[model samples]
Target: MSGNGERVVFVLDAPGDESLHTGGTIARLLDDGADVTVLFGSATSYDSDASAPTTASAGAADVAAARAALGETDPAQWRVLAGEPQGAQRRAVLGEAFAQAHATAVVAAAVDPALRQAAVDAAGEQGVPVFLSSRVSAVPGVRLTAIDVSDHIDKKLAALAAYPGRWRLDGRVVRLIDGTEALVTGTETYASGSGPAQPAELEAPTVGSRLLAVLMALFAGALFGVLGTVAHQTTIELGSLTIPVGLTLALLASGTLLLGLRLVVHDRLVVLAAAIGLVATVFLLSLRSTGGSVLVPAGVPGTVWSMAPALFAALVIAWPRIPARRPTA
Candidate 1:
């Protein structure tokens, strides 16, 4: 979907609670041109059959009305399944649905424990990742990712309006009731393992944040450069050969630091900032002082130290960006 071509399936509980919890994220996905399919589960009881009917119940109409309000005009994008099956039956039904949709990732609400577990199990069997809608909790081995849906807050609110019985809109705020403390928010958080359902391209950082990153990178690079320069001269006598272990370690540390920034920040400008600080520090230290003393003497170790950091910086800055791969069925 979009340029990434990912088909995301959302298995949700009731038309109101689960929808409110993930409406903003749903709207964002649809806006991104991703192929989004929503499967709304039956709230009343679990249907035992593997092949449940797709009949339009009263709840199904509410789901349709909500989808329409959320800008999901395409009728085929959603389906109201007849039952919420349990045990192996539930897994089988959900598994078949996921396979049919060829879902790259599944977003399941935690409102219904059975449905949530079934979705997770089905997705795991297919090797597809699952995202659970809820606040970040300490789940061992799971990574938490928060999506900023502030841009689609209005659409989410509109969708919530469909369930007037549950949510009440008071002026600009949407609350659970007229005097309740619970309210809807613009940000939606989810927990996943390995690949979270983040946007294909993250939103660009604000100018202020970018500037802060650059400044921090520059300072960190300068600090590392100073430490490396100080320790680059130490040598270890191993039998007949003199091993410049300090020089090797220093170079390795600088390279590792720069590589980490490139991989984590995913920003060339920030990397360039750090590189400039490191290379500039080494250059300054290499120059002979007015009193005729030099920190980095003219030698093999000095020459390598002078040039290695700049080369490492160039490689990191020039490295091509690779798109993340989602697990396949």
Candidate 2:
């Protein structure tokens, strides 16, 4: 946020006073000529003993070292702050800093919805953009950016080397990061910089949120199972094969599950969970409904009827948010 129109980026809400998770992203941002400000705490990490340099100190020192190593040394281009708290306090400090630096984008990692909401509000106040970073696949419908960082691995590792005591970039760590893709998410309101996004709209994808979605899935599953049970008995057998009728009912059951989930769920991932629950429930119910009895003549048709509901449920639930497919050579 300089008068010279340089893009200012804020990296915040990182855990345990460590940039090992986000160091590379920060380096890539700096290399892209953006003024990056890294804010982290000093006393937050238990691993940081009395002898170690905190991430705050390491951040300042590392940025300086990296700049010097890269043959650039302008102090105004970056700054690192220690002891920035989250939630309302974070909002105040973040707002003031963003205003002072005229920040353009804020990258927050592992922050709760409340803190993120506060930060996004601050961003909206100034009409600036915000990005939420996540490493989980539990829920990912709102993701906004998903850039691959393999190209900037060298610079990222070089930046990590700034904290010598604990964070020497290892080959295993690099491969882990390279293998696991990062997911950045934000609500639709995030697109409207000047408008505040709803809190529920930005589900924080915490363990609690994930469990809640699982529960919803279970409920949806039960509902779909009950309906499919009644419909399965009505399927007309076709000679030796009952695949056609069973498949049709399965497709219908899948559609029913999808529609029911949409009526009650907000998150796409939640809908997926419910659909999965529906499949499991259908299979279990089918097993029970059959009661170890074979069909009058078409036993194969009975098996087809038993399996169709679950199969269709899976297909519908997984269709909307399929993960990005990897490119093959």
Candidate 3:
């Protein structure tokens, strides 16, 4: 749902996995004008017989041919990541790939467990929606999205044809040569952690949009500062004890605003903008007004109210980003 267009990244274990699982979806996405990027892990051995084992370069060529058969002509779109898909470096590389592509959605079609997990984690951390292929084992509570690839089945078959001995196509039906498996369906299934419940529009934020967000954040912060300043003096007096309810609520609100922005928005600059606005507003309000009246009078409640929000904002802003949880089995 990105304004620039729908850019999809397919994470695959090998060249043939794309044709086996997501061939139809890939063809359909290409026909719809969505930019498709295929990232294959270390090449897979396609030959079941040891005498005719497929080399890495050969497997890569076959996948490139498959993509070509599906009408993906741009060689740049097909990439093979070096090294095993494990460790933080691999995850970081995948994250950078998604970020660079401005991917709207990710398809985790890799059969490798580590690769699958890495893809899911990378996409989730970036807040990009990732769909797992049926090749991936099902985890309960997760939602599924089935794509009707009836119209693109022919293109899928054409792509599969690239894998000579691995897949055999007869007319409209295709069978995997590995023995008792057949693929003649018009539907391709993909599962997501939340399914389609939480839709994400993954366009990279532009300079203009970021500036506007910062300005709005500043306005929001200033607004809260003014509100907190005006309300910090209220108290509930019961017997000899006076409960500073207003001051407590003001500090709570400040913490919530800053923390929520940091976690939900995941944009430090915006949170910093809001913090600046809030603190500045508080400081300005603490000074005497034109009418010689102080909104934040000097006292324990006033001091705490004036200082707590900035401290809360600082702590929230300084908090290190925690990686998102990986999809469960």
Candidate 4:
């Protein structure tokens, strides 16, 4: 297999008249079954009688030469475009050319920094791969490695082609190696967006919170215990009738029900149940001590004190799983 999809190699003339380098690259790409486009400067004498030099005349001549070179070529296989002096204009021209050419890869001379930067930027915008020629001499039978510092698509493709079996493409980075495992890395020049955030793990309860919760539960339990003991000890009378054992049982049962609700239910419901139970327990206990009179009111405050521990535990358990706010699609 020839790897993934169809590949197109772009060759542009360098600043120092490096058309030979560009031509060699084009030939190699053609041999590898890649469609090739050679964008040469108008100053070259391939067609000597073309045109003379006025700013307007030069631009027209360059455009004509590019058109002539690309004419009669298969739309699927090859194309050519000329570069302008202005960076923005060049970028716009190259962008349109790459789109029209359906170029999959770019191989341009690395000698011109401005042109190289422009080409790289255009390739990125088009989502095409790029390869930069290095100054180092190529050793016989040794593969050339392209490093992807920025993880751009063009650089990765070049690295894949140049190193083949000895290359690894990771995200935006490509790792290239020789037969002996010796490496030369090239930096990619592209950017990808950030990934999603990960969820956090739940942590153990803190010493202080645990201690406070326990103390609150104990305090509530102790109040009920005291009331039970008191109701057992005291006697009460109402309208010529004696109520001793019944009042004691009522207070004990109320306390038990509240305690059970607090343990079984969630925190939100715990407080209400705890309050009612505590009030009943306190009133019954007070009746035993005060001869069945309503002088000492039910201990409503005691319910709050007793429910504190349960509330704390509920808070701790629910905090870690709190729902996060999701972004709008």
Q: Quick one: best lDDT, which candidate? A: 3
Worst 10 residues of 4 by lDDT: 192-201
User: With candidate 2 superimposed using the best TM-score fit, by how many Å does residue 26's alpha carbon deviate from the native?
Assistant: 3.1
lDDT of 2: 0.51
Sort by TM-score, best first: what order?
1, 3, 2, 4
lDDT ranking from best to worst?
A: 3, 1, 2, 4
- lDDT, candidate 3, equals 0.78
Model 3 spans > 4 angstroms off: 1-4, 45-60, 194-329
Instruction: Give the true-structure RMSD of model 4.
Output: 21.5
Error of 3 at 144 (Å): 1.8
Candidate 3 lDDT by residue in tens digits, 90-173? 888899999999988999887666677788888888889888886554545444567777888888888888887566777766
TM-scores of all predicted structures: 0.56, 0.45, 0.53, 0.31
For residues 1-329, write the lDDT of model 4, one tens digit per residue: 03235455454432112221232333333334555654432332221123222221123333333223323134433223443444677767766776776877765443344455566677777767665554311223222343222222332234233322333545434443322222323331111111112111123456776556555544564465445534543456788986567345635554554445454432423434344345444444445344554433445433432343345334433443233232111
lDDT (Cα, tens digit) per residue for candidate 2, span 249-271: 75576677676665445456776
Sum up the clashes in candidate 1. 2
Which one is best on TM-score? 1
Residue 210, candidate 2: C-alpha displacement in angstroms: 17
TM-score-wise, the better of 1 and 3 is 1
